[model samples]
Target: MKKILHAGNNLKGKQANPTYISFLGPKLEAVGFTLYYTSQKQNKVLRLIDMLLSVYKYRAKVDLVLIDTYSTSNFYYAFLVAELCNLLKTPYITILHGGNLPKRLDKSTWKSKRLFKHSKLNIAPSKYIMHEFKKRAYSNIKFIPNALNIEKYEVTERGCERLKLLWVRSLTPIYNPDMALEVVRLLQNEGLDVSLTMVGPDPHNKFEELKETINNKKLRIEYKGKLKQEEWYKLSENHNIFINTSNFDNMPITLIEAMALGLPLVSTNVGGIPYLIEDGKEGLLCNKDDALTMVNCIKKIHKNPDLRQSLIVNARSKAESFSWQNVKALWISALA
Candidate 1:
């Protein structure tokens, strides 16, 4: 069995949602690969130190180091870790993430090149990221869609008697949680009976602003801060629609989970979302921050039963292609 050191935010119980490492580590282990993970430390500085130390400690023991590369300040963590791997003559792979990463490549060209070009492989979860890297002439990149256990997600029939909108993501500025509230407000203003439930942690304290807006506007919005996967899956049974209002995103696992649960999707067509859901096919997409368009998309789904059924069937089909059974071979081949 190959020994792999996976480095990323393994913050499953740390008041944050499970990231890629948290999900992928166990899957790899179950498939006969020995996996080690690093840096569940919440503090940024301490986390960086821990990640660096883990790389140094496991440098000789592990066959490969899997770095979860992102576009934010955490990008620096990936850069430093990859450089450490390079200096220690250890093979490493970068699992690319975040929709803003293409911008990061342009903004930090030299750093991006050093970090990605020297890696053993660059794994892109979406074609958007793959295309962006290929555009810059990077040949070490490969497309591997993110995986989930499709059997765990139970699909339920959606009754269109009332609109129950579900939004699942961190309450961050980039995700634009406020847009969800606005979409709900617009639907209600147009004399539609709609209620929204937002599930996510407020890492940046944006929930305070959202709470104020919900109170002031008197919208029927329920803010359930940071639920476990199963908890939210149960909550999803009450919801008929899943809305993603992120201003920027990669291929979000939540959207795929929503598809598996048979919730018709209405998302902003930003970043890699278009690559995930074709407009009017698997789901409906609108411009970023355009609450009105999202409202219209919801209205379209609610009014048209055939369209809703088509979206649910098509989306669930697309999501099944991302199951772990199908995707594990890609990982096994890439790792080999």
Candidate 2:
């Protein structure tokens, strides 16, 4: 069997683990590619060193390498690893995951140049990043969305009366977990029968403060820390609406999974979210950190049965486009 060396920060402890390497690596292995991983270390500098060593160690063992390139500080990891891969003469491909990566081009032009130029190809899971790279004359890029096994999701009918809101992502400041709490508080103040369930690991230890705010405000919220893929989908059956309050986002698999399970989304129009969700179409979009607008959106969806069902139908249709059955061929062609 051929081999693949995947280099990325595998969010090992996070509950809503949407790491692309974890999702795609096994799929590649099932099709006869032996997958190897590096750098589950939380520290950034150590992770970069680990990734470099991984490339050197697997230099002759792997068929190709896959790097998860981000637009944030982690972008340096991709650059350093790509430089090592170039010296080793190993062909590598990068999967772009940063929503704010367009700025990376202007800020770190030289590094971005070296990273993409050395790679055999760059796979962008969202058109948001793909368009930005293309405009900058980066031609070694391919648009392939983050995908999931559709068979795993179970769809259920949702009552538009009670707002059973669900938020799934790591409890990090960037994701703005606090924003979800504030939205729930605002809605409850208006006497809306709303409840929020947040499912994800708190890597930053922010749970105590978050819990205090919830208790202080007396909000109807439940924190289910870190659920398995199957467990979350099963939990979705008891919920209706899915909320994504990320300050920055890429093609989030949880958002796609929610749509597949027929959950209408009310998310901030930041990063790649707009690219994935069309306002008043597949899902509702609001401004970042605007609790009032989110409250209004939830009220709109709750009152209008027609609008709610329309979003469900359209979102599910759009989600079907990202199923593994549809994306498997793209991976096969890329690897071949």
Candidate 3:
């Protein structure tokens, strides 16, 4: 039996998507891999003593280590794990999860430079990101999207009449939830029969105020904060149209979730979004911050039955490629 240490954050208390950590860790274990977990929050200065102590504690039995990578503060986390891996002489894989990094492992800092330059493998979830890695001239790169069990996957499709537009994202500034709200306002001013549902927990404390502002402006919208994935899954069943208003993103798991559930998307064309959805094909694409374009797409999809069905059918087909059974194999191969 092989042993693996999975180092990452425990987001249960912080209201984060722990899907990548907990779910993928256990699934890897079921395939005869013994797993261990260590939660290291993003951007915390690494206490060299503690990390060295951890290596001494677990080094004897751990055969391999897996570290989840990110572009922001979490990038530091992977570097720390990579250092520990070096000291222990354990083969480690860094699963890069950001949209910004080029596929190459080379970097200016010793941490990234060493990890990219020396790690046994580097796994990116999207080709959009993998190509970024390729620029670094690293040959160990592979693509493996996050894991979602397709057998248990069920999509909820709301009626077009409901016309409930949804944006499932934190109200953090980077996601630009305001753009979705602006679209809501634009459609309302045009007297469109629409209601926007802004789900998920807000990090910036702006959602209630955004909700109030929408009401003051007489826009039709409902702000439901922080829904559990399961609860949101049920809510999504009644939602026929999905919208993503992200400034920059790697492949979004939520968009894929919506696609699998048969939602026709009206998304801003940005980052990995274009890779997942094609204009007038799998889903509709609008320029980022162009509220009226989103408004037009909403009206277009709502009115045309065949067009809506075409998008839904194609979106679901695109989603089949992201199934956990398919994605996990990539991870297993990279690990091997």
Local accuracy by lDDT, each model: 0.93, 0.89, 0.76
Per-residue C-alpha lDDT of model 3 across residues 1-336, encoded as one tens digit per residue: 678877766455454554477778878888777888765443245433344455557888887777777777667667877887887788888777766554223444556678776788887777777776676566778777765766655755457875788789877775788888888788777777778888876666887678677868887778778887777778877667889888777888888888888888999887778877899999999887788888899899999999999998898888887777787667677777
Better of 2 and 3 by TM-score: 2
How far out, in Å, is residue 325 in model 1? 0.5
Q: Rank all candidate structures by their lDDT, best first, as comma-separated numbers.
A: 1, 2, 3
Which segments of candidate 3 are over 4 A away from where they belong? 40-56, 103-111
Q: Which RMSD values do the candidates have, in order?
A: 0.9, 1.7, 2.7
Q: For candidate 1, lDDT tens digit of each residue in 146-221?
A: 9999999988976999999999998888899989989988998998999999998888778787789899999999
Please provide TM-scores, in order, for all candidate models, with all chains considered together.
0.98, 0.95, 0.90
The sequence of per-residue lDDT tens digits that candidate 2 reaches over residues 16-66 is: 355788889888888887899987887778888889999999999998999
The TM-score measured for candidate 1 stands at: 0.98
In model 3, what lDDT does residue 30 have?
80
* Worst 10-residue lDDT window, candidate 2: 10-19
